[model samples]
Target chain A: MSHNTFPHADHDPRAVRLAARDGTLVGPTAGLAKGFVQVNLVILPEAQANGFLRFCQSNPKPCPLLAVSEPGERGCAALADDLDIARDVPAYCLYRDGRLDQTVHDVSDVWRDDLVTFALGCSFTFEHALIQDGLPVRHIDEGRNVPMYRTSVPLVPAGGFAGHLVVSMRPYRASDAIRAIQITTRFPQTHGAPVHLGDPALIGITDLHSPDYGDAVSMGDDELPVFWACGVTPQQVLMDAGIAFAITHSPGHMLITDIPDSRVALL
Target chain B: MSHNTFPHADHDPRAVRLAARDGTLVGPTAGLAKGFVQVNLVILPEAQANGFLRFCQSNPKPCPLLAVSEPGERGCAALADDLDIARDVPAYCLYRDGRLDQTVHDVSDVWRDDLVTFALGCSFTFEHALIQDGLPVRHIDEGRNVPMYRTSVPLVPAGGFAGHLVVSMRPYRASDAIRAIQITTRFPQTHGAPVHLGDPALIGITDLHSPDYGDAVSMGDDELPVFWACGVTPQQVLMDAGIAFAITHSPGHMLITDIPDSRVALL
Candidate 1:
């Protein structure tokens, strides 16, 4: 895709998704959907969808559900007027019998009649808010993915879905951390507020320099690492549960929606 | 004064202050005026009042000015209809040449023509908010003073007033601390959000067990020490500057205002 042709294109999330849907944009959707809600995509068989939905409801801190599509449907009108779940996302990961089978750009080939699609809220919605409020996002500044860590804090079990809570780490100064907490609290759908702050060891993460996923950003001498529940949690839980026939958005490749980020703010 | 008589007294700030004005109640104004704006009293000679007012404006976090009375004024009608500055408070501290001269139940005896009174918002307003939100204040639970410490963070200088910032400490679990920050942010008059949290040593305090002012409350392993800019800051600055004559409320004996706490919330 020609970057120059898409001036202020990212500001309109639907436009960005349309470009992705047309196979013209095949990059991460971080800055692409500037002011709209981007989501973590999860597709499961109809038999397991009810259990996963209950899991999200019970463990809202880690899995804030934004939208859920009807069984065998590939569109979610609430998120976007024409959001095609099979192709709107930049990339998708396929899993079979609880193991990674292949990574694909679209899932139209293997669309199952009983498959249900769930669109869970992602941290990008709150991060956009934090940046708009003048708080610096270190990962964005470094042009890297937000560091994700699997904490010892276990999620509340629901039927066949159960696993430890996964968190995204962002280093901020004490004042910035306080402001971040307040900013994020407004978006309950986006994993509102922070799960833990200050020491990483408190949540069972041993090292500050190493992250289970994404690149490690610098933690200044005066800064503390603030952790927010990540959407990667469902993926981990699904893998751990050894579920058959599941699909998730590739890391950083979110499913952009028409829902403005401001619409998701509870405040 | 009989304690049983003031049953619904604390529920209404105006009623509580009215009781003090009528000489019917003269004791610690802590528990008596709940959900009301209690204030730190600072009465200075008109010659020094403007400088002190400038001092407060510069160091708002510590000395958030709620209302200021004109020289020789006995009432701040904006705060209350029958509020008498001379006798509305439970107790007053009379200072002479930067030295503690005497403590009086009422300051009507030392009233001066050039005296100007300042009613700065107190943490009691926010404490009520915290408790209402189900966060337990350790000092209030232990029936002790909220531990206060003098920090290396210097207040902005105005005229002849400048000193290290004084902070009141409240320990809470990390989650509760986040909620406390959100709750207090609504009331900017009551010092707004916390100034610093976590390590006391980061702000130059050596020990959490021994505070520079007020009694020390126990901190649990799961708790993080949160600090808010204290109203005692002005008193400390006055003491440090060695002001010739100044009158303030005695510790624990604040000036109960007629303003309701809900009125101070920015939201």
Candidate 2:
């Protein structure tokens, strides 16, 4: 599947979402809307939405909830003018009984009145800010997914949503690592700051070369592996919760939102 | 030396300076005027002032020059009104021919016609901000001078001023360390943010306990040692430059200024 390419592409957030809805953008939306916010989609039944909200509040670093819809709601009013919960995402992962069942184009046909949509802010917002500030984003440059690890660090459990924290890693030189911390702190709605840095083992991850999820990018001898609370975390926790049914954006196939990145920056 | 005990002192910046001037506050000014900016005082002959200015500009992290005086001057008008640099500081370290010849209460008697005083932003300003923001500053709590280490990290050399960087250490849990970085970044004039965190060996320090200056603080197994560009760095570099004579505020005995700490915070 062809991903969004830069420079020649229109790179408008709404255009990307429209393409996704029309099935013309059926791949990773990583590079599609460069300066806009993209989100991790989570659609759950109203029975589990309250527990999920509590989980997100307790584990803000990992699951920084951007928007939550009313039961059976289809649009997140703050995200975009006409963002359809079932169709705006590039692709959707339909989970059943704590297992990956099938990947689908859209979920409208299967959507239920009890289904609630959640949009969790993704690291791509801060990553774009970092790049704009001239900081090198290792995974993007390497053309791979940001290496992620399931850490031994436990999340503050909220009811049925309980699990260990998951983190995404990006290696930076010592100074740049400090800088990335500052840059990311501005986007609290999007995971905010790094959860841990330096030694990976401190967070209970053993090997840098062997990430539990996503491709492992090489670390420079002088580079420090900076870890941020990942959006994948909510998915992992929701999975561990043994949810009977759920839907999420597939891997890099995020929901493109009309929200500009800087709007999220804090003073 | 009696440190300023919390909650029962005047704690006014001008009061602190007056006490210093009257020889009543003849010790470290750590807790005095808690919310006002304190500065590292450096007085040098006109011949070396230009070189020192260039050095501070080149090595900003360590020697973030806040105010520079005109030739033959002993005042920093912008730092504090009616500020007589020769007597505002509680204690002065007089360096002659690359050595600490003597420390004095005031430099008024030894003041030269060509002397130019410089006030560099001290880490205390940001440290106060950190503590206000509810982050623990180890040295203050432990009642000791902040641990200063000579590192292998070299400073950008300028005419007649060259030396490896000297860093002050502050240990914090991973999350607090991230907060500390963000807080300190707001005060760029005060050695903005940390130069490095995590392993000391990465910056070429072999032993944490064997610090070149100041008292060492304990590090918890989970705490990361955050290193900031210390004010001592400029004094060290200037000492190595072999100036005929120079005067600096003794460690922790900073110049208490009327400038409010929040005045320096960046938006």
Candidate 3:
């Protein structure tokens, strides 16, 4: 997302959260509170939280954990001040028996005492770094969602959770691809460096134009389709595992946390 | 080169240098003193030394300077305890008006009082790091010299020094290529990260199989040709500029230094 998308967006994470809580700002969170850390939300029942946490730990590239909320608790104090897990996200996805049930603005009405909230690192952090470093992110330039593919590359299975890896693709020329690798390597929390580059078929991605998820962006003949582990992988894994109930932030509608993006950089 | 090529090679840099000085090691210095820094040598008259140094500074990726000796000095104490500019290399190349004059085991006889010695970082250091990290070096595996090419990419000129950039190619699968980039980035003293990968034509290299220097190693269908600025760049630049007199270590016959490879790593 670019500054043009959020010309009057609040610069404070608290303001963004308050807007979400009041049902006043109900759209994608991209470019809002620009320097703050935005995260992917996943809420599961207490019975499945441990297994899901193990899954995230095992597959860090796709599901790098930022913070975990206590069972039945709404406040994630580590992420932000006055944060409410049930209402702070711009939009939420409620799932039932491996299927998406509904997309809602708030989940307070459906909040459960047995639920546990998880915050996973999002690629927005590294994309911001890339743009700042004068690297072009094709999707951002094309005003489309980053194209994502479900690859045959399997994730290390953790108790009751198993699925193929899902990756987000961004096209870059060879030199820029190398620079992107160096820049993203400093942000391990945000997927680190690319998993595969040059060949899509090598990673079991059959078609470049037809992504399994997100909008496909244009690629130049000189560009290579670079793939990184995506946050969507966890939602797919939840569906594959046939979980009874779960909630995730709707695509592009992430949770804006008080943490600065720089704080999450490994370097 | 592999370990078998140096069945009884000395592990100590000092011992390797002693062997070179005693005329017992009159060949390529690969696989000797394995963990130490091996440098490319260049000795020129004092008249052209400053301009040559500026050229190196301007084009660091190609001519990463390790140490420079004062005019007429025959020793560089920073590189090793007893390093001699005229005799430590396994073989020396004497050039007159940029043309090959002779190849000799030592340059002590012709070494002038007005000569200045320049020691440049070589690719061997990072190659060692790559091998230690379990990545394959194709040329080393095939027992062939790393392929070197003259690219259309030009060097930043200094005074009378100007020429196209020279690059060394190593083929690797995409994942291994990413890992090699990371591994090599730590050794800036070496050539650091790759300059380009994927297309040779973009860099004005029309053919990969027919390199201008060194043996052409085999590339697999699964691999991408990763290129790094080569030490031979200065030698090529020197030839293009037509310097009156100069001395360089023969190809693959490097000057072993006391500095450990790990010691040169930035990280």
Q: Best TM-score goes to which candidate?
A: 3
lDDT of 1 by residue, B1-267 (tens): 564465644357667666767777666777776666788889999999999999999988899999899999988886778678888776788888888888887788789889999988888889988888899999999989999999999889997899899999999887788899999999889899999888788898999999999999998887889999998899989988898999999887887766778899987
Where is model 3 chain B poorest over a 10-residue stretch in terms of lDDT?
B1-10
Query: Can you tell me the CAPRI class of model 3?
Result: medium
- TM-score leaderboard ranking: 3, 1, 2
- Record all residue pairs in model 1 with backbone atoms less than 3 Å apart, i.e. clashing: B97-B244
Please compute the TM-score of chain B alone for each predicted structure, in the order given: 0.95, 0.95, 0.97
Better of 2 and 3 by DockQ: 3
Winner by DockQ: 3
TM-score of chain A of each: 0.96, 0.96, 0.97
Candidate 2 has an lDDT of 0.86
Docking class of 2: medium
List model 3 lDDT by residue over B156-265, tens digit each. 87957999999999999999999998888888878899999998999999999999999899998889999999999999888888889999999999999999898889
DockQ for all candidate structures vs. native: 0.60, 0.71, 0.76
Sorted by DockQ (best first), the order is 3, 2, 1
Error of 3 at A67 (Å): 1.5
- Once fitted onto the true fold, the runs of candidate 3 whose alpha carbons sit more than 4 angstroms away are A1-10, B1-10
